[model samples]
Target: MTPSIAGACGTRLIAQVLIAATVFSGTAARAQESVQTFPVAPSYPAAMPASPLGASVSALLDHARTTNPAFAAQRAETAAARERIESAGALPDPNFQVELMDFTNTMRGGGTTLLPGQVGETRYRIIQPLPGWGKRELQSRAAGAKADQAAAGLDAAWLDLATEIKNAWLRYYTADREAALARESLALLGGLEEAMLARYRQGLAPQQAVLRAQRELTSQRLAQVGIEQRRRGAAAALNGLLARAPDAPLATPADPAALPAALELPALVARARARNPALTADERGIEAARLERERTWADRYPDFSMGLTNNRPRGESQSWDLMFEVMIPLQQSARRAREREAEHMLAAADARRDATGSRLAGEIGAAYANFTSGQETQRLIRSTLLPQARATRDATRAAFETGRADFDAVLEAERQLVDTRMALLQAEVESRMALFELEKLVGDAL
Candidate 1:
């Protein structure tokens, strides 16, 4: 064979070997990453067995509902609203009165009677005010609608609390993962530094490689410090949700469970329509306004009062009298004003309901999009980018050991791997958070 042809064949064979090695390294790195678990303290508790972070979330929510003053206040308001219904339907209390009339004192020859039995005509009366026809019923309906609105408000408060807790928890999880990854990368860089120093001592690698590795290790350590700070802040925020002291310790699940399957958007929107608490509250407001308008119309009629009287005159038989009274609704202008106010209020409630529904739909759409995109990105990173970065890192390290590549190339590859891993973690956390938000918007679990 010609010399030039042999040289070309040799070069091609080396290239093939490198390519094969690269592929093998990638496969190995992917296997390693799949089995890798973040560092956990021996005393740390195991994650709850059921749903992903379900136990922790439930405990937090229970604490907020039971101990949080805001939640308690909302519940109290709901109870008060419910009590008003009975008051709205009840009749006015009966009034009682007593009168003395036609009493006379007679004196003859400077003599006065000690007692004059039944000398005065005494009268006793009781009166009861009755609401106009259908007025009390209308009032009761309005009150009931208000109670429903209050109940919906309570539900909304609960949902908000739960969402807040979930968000804080997710943030903590992300920060924790970031810290763990930084620590792992630092440890890896430390090992590399030791290897580089050994190689330097043997005069095989330059002193600069050791210094570069040390610098990278220091950077990773600094990053870990920042991550720890973030993790602490996130934990404190979560503690606040649980109504605990800011520095209270919290245990998060070690494994961020897999992403949930995508839900149908139409189904979610429909469910939200039926179950969203804010929308329900707006609907109740509309009903209450309508009922109030009806009540105002009923108020245009006159109310009535009935009375019973007992009377006794001096030397006369006891007598009973019946009396009826009516209230004239003479203030037509005021009644019309009230009716107009109620009509406007009803229209305002309807407009608010429409706005709320639109806002909710938009929120659902955004959350769903975020979740879906995060899921896809996470999958891509885990299945492709992460493995590729790891493979490049391994290949670069091997090439550097063989004097075929520079230390800078190895460092860059390692950095890429770290970044890919962090991105995957972030995407996973974001996906989970988006799911929580979506569930909250839908008013039910997926």
Candidate 2:
């Protein structure tokens, strides 16, 4: 009986173990099934982040100033030039030296009373160089002018960077809007294709209509792809210019809202002439060159060095002697050559300044004209063409549904409408870019 009981208990233990093992295995399988496996594929949507329309112009300018290599380099140069101004005005440190004198005498000289020697004399001397009248002031002015020129260069760089960033941002937004328009066209084409297929099935249209619709859809699709590719390429290029990663996704901005009212050409020109950093920089260049030429001649007058020498006699009967020396300018050939070179350089600088001024004026005029033209064009498109085109598309669609028009007519109407909208968007973008260019030339409106 005890043996039977033992066998029964053993069987129960084995059953419990098997039950536990089955439950654990089932749970493991369930967990495995619950885990999801993803494929190793690059996803465009995953890489893209949500960016709303209309980024800030101020932010873009800030980014350009901070990131642009040319701007950074110019800023560094300006700082270095400022440091040079301090160095240029500083006086040379005084030099000090010590000398020891000793005499070796023979027995006959030591015993003889002809000349007695003190044996040795120690001396200390200091030499200081003093600049001539107005020399230090000239040097200081020249260095200050150079520093000012560098500062002007830095300002120009900042203006240029802001302008470039604005233009690139406009182009990027334009491409994005164009891509959106292309996608809308593709959708319209798809709808047309569906209509054409339906007509063919009903034996109301020929195979040619279906083929035509298919071809149009494919073309629209290709166009959408091309526009998207262009957008991406433009974004990458802008990012490169801004010193950002090429793969960083760009955010599309909304169309510029409105134009600045009371646009006066004369006022803009005057502002640009006065405020433009490029013109100011050129002006500073002319001054710097003139000063540089003066410095060449001024430096030709050799710097004066005064030295005082103390001579200590070996004999007690001899007194100490003092000698003073001065160095004179003697290299006439080198000085004349440098002077002539500086004069020629000054002339060249003046001529260059004039040429730059004329070019800057022309650029300002061109940018102003473009801005005004874009504003008018955008106004016309917005206030007239776009509305008319949209109304025409609606009418055509209604007429076609009522059998008063055909598919071809509706398609043409839709194309006109889409084109008009896109054209307006482009005009707005172009106007903003032109305004940016104008502002760059003018330095700042505020």
Candidate 3:
């Protein structure tokens, strides 16, 4: 080919390559947008509540941890279990007896002898019992396992308490925000109503416009009353969690717990399996069950007892005697039935542990989904829809003032903006709750 022809071909090839690169870049950007996920939690609402409660959520959580009667009761249970370990391995209390032998001979003399020396024979005996072979150890081990299970349960209780406090705090925050947002809307509508009345008086707008504005304002005020009521109820619930009186005042919730970075389902599942209190308790239950089964089997063995007796004859020297006894393990059917019961219980414990693991995975999956969706929903509203709705309302109201648009159009736009704000608040609360729920399942902060 000629040099000119070759140069033209090279230029065409470079142009084609650039075109392909542009297409690929656009595709990559679209793909990234489709799969975008928040690695860290979004910022809390920039605006804080006007009414301040007495304490922050963090403080409330700490107070609940320290003062909640449930936790103290759980601790007491653990201590009680530990105390039982020694009792489980203890021997039966010794038995003591006093006997009058040859009482007929004494009575034959036509006189009842009250004294040991006057009787033909008198005896004193004591016996000490020993538990069956290996029974003490098994019993002690079972008790120890029970104590362990109690400890695990205590850990689970902590997660439960945290979940409750965080959830209640979120509920209060949602209601507070909703009430505040409604008030703002009421004020906005009131202004619009005044303006619409002025326009109606001037014959620039219809009377219906002013009437619609008044209705919306009244409806908003009524809704605010309910929202405030719910907020107060939420506060009461939170106070109860903190072990305070139900009517005790609580501070407004500030921000939600920060979300974990690079949240991954697999990682969360791993953490849950390793540390989830419920799962841990199940494992402890399995161990306790196994020990209990062993203890039941140990019951098939015989228990032994030893005794000593001192005998005295009237007007004679005393004699000492020793005796030993062992329990006969009779009733094979009863023993076997007990063993079967323990076996079934152990199997139940194993099944329970496995089921908990399965449920843990499912819970983490659900929480992860909720957390990601909520964050994305709020982010979209805050970044795009909220602003767009606000702009639409402003534009429509301006048009209505100029007699270029209908009053209903302005009302519709205003309603849309209010809904968007409400939705944003709901999403924020949802995201916060989901993140905390995830942590509760994992038994620790992610």
Candidate 4:
């Protein structure tokens, strides 16, 4: 009886252990399934941040100055030229030299040696070169003028880039606007087609009306393809300017820019003469050339150098000597050649300045004329032509629905409305682009 009790208790303990093992194994499997072994992928922002620059003109210009390689190159060029201002006036590096005199005498008794400390006499010298009176100042002034010229060149590059950015922005915005218009027109046509179908069912419209409606729908869809292409192309051009990939996505444009106010031709021309980057660059070039000529002429004078020499002689005390030297302007032919070069460069610089000014005036005049005329046309269309077309379209559609007007009349009115809208869009874009060009030439917005 005791042996039976022992066997039964052992069996119960073994069964309990097996049940616990099963529960633990099941939990381990679930825990393994819950855990992840692979690394999570990183996420990146879109190519064009939403509201980056907020489409502000200043923000855009600043961003371009920071990112565009060509613009950055211009900035670097300006900086390098400006650096010459400091270096041009600096005194020439002082000369230093050492001489070991009769060192072999010390080696006469001892094994041959060439040590400075064992020499019989040693000499050390330092010389400092100084330019003639007014020479260094002239050189510094010349460098300053050159730096100004480089700065003007950088401004010119910026103006050109700004115009391109503005034009591209306008193109992108116009494409979107045109697409919206097309979509609206498509929806309106869809409603009109439905109305036409109902009329046909009631025996109020002809069968061809339904076919014409379908055909118009197809044509509208085809037009959207071109609009989409325009948007993509504009986006690509903009991305290139922003130093991004051609296919990078861009956020939608914000509010449109307001129309700029008008200015008189004389005023614009005067402003262009004063602030235009090309003209300023040319003027600075003339100044630089003139200063360079003066600086070169100053080079015809002699330069002076002061030197200190230390001397020691065998069986003698050390002595210090001060010496002065003058550089003679002996290369007469070379000086004459350089002078002639400077004169020619000055002449060329003056001529370029004149030509640049004349060209600037003409460009400003032409842009002003175009911008003014375009502005007037845009205003007229917006105030009069567009409203008239819209009214005509609404009236014709209503009349056709009541059987008072023909289907041809309704189609003609819709076509006229579309054409008028397109004309308005084209006018606005062209005028704004003209304004941008004008501003570029003037070097500031009017």
Candidate with best TM-score: 1
Backbone clash pairs for candidate 3 read 53-251, 53-252, 54-251
- RMSD (Å) of each candidate, 1 decimal: 7.9, 18.8, 14.9, 21.7
Candidate 1: global Cα-lDDT?
Answer: 0.75
- lDDT of the candidates, in the order given: 0.75, 0.64, 0.74, 0.74
Per-residue accuracy of model 4 over 1-446 as CA lDDT, tens digit each: 23223344443443343344334433432332232111110111124434555243444555666788888888998999999999998989999978788777753344344566467777888999989999989999999999999999988888888788777777877787778668766765666666666555555567898789888988998998899999999989887887878898766666554566566899888889998988999999999999999988998999999999998765678899999999999999999999999999999999999999899888888888887887788778778997788679767765664468866687778778777777877876777777777788888865
**Regions of model 2 farther than 4 Å from truth:** 1-54, 93-125, 296-302, 308-324
Clashing pairs in 2: 54-254
Order of quality (TM-score): 1, 4, 3, 2
| lDDT per residue (tens digit) for residues 1-446 in model 1 | 23233344444443454455456445544543563332211111234335432225554565566777788889999999999999999998999987656444332122333334444567889999999999989889899999999999888888887788777777776787677667667756765666666555555566777788888888888888999999899888887777788997777645544456567888889999999999999999999999988888888889999999998665678899999999998999988999899899999999999999999999999998998899889779878997688778877867865668876787798789878887877777677777888778887766
Candidate 4: misplaced stretches above 4 Å?
Answer: 1-58, 103-113, 247-249
Tens digits of lDDT, candidate 3, 39-109: 22111112333445433455555566678898889888889988998998888899998888766564446
Q: Report the lDDT of model 3 for residue 314.
A: 70
TM-score of each: 0.83, 0.76, 0.82, 0.82
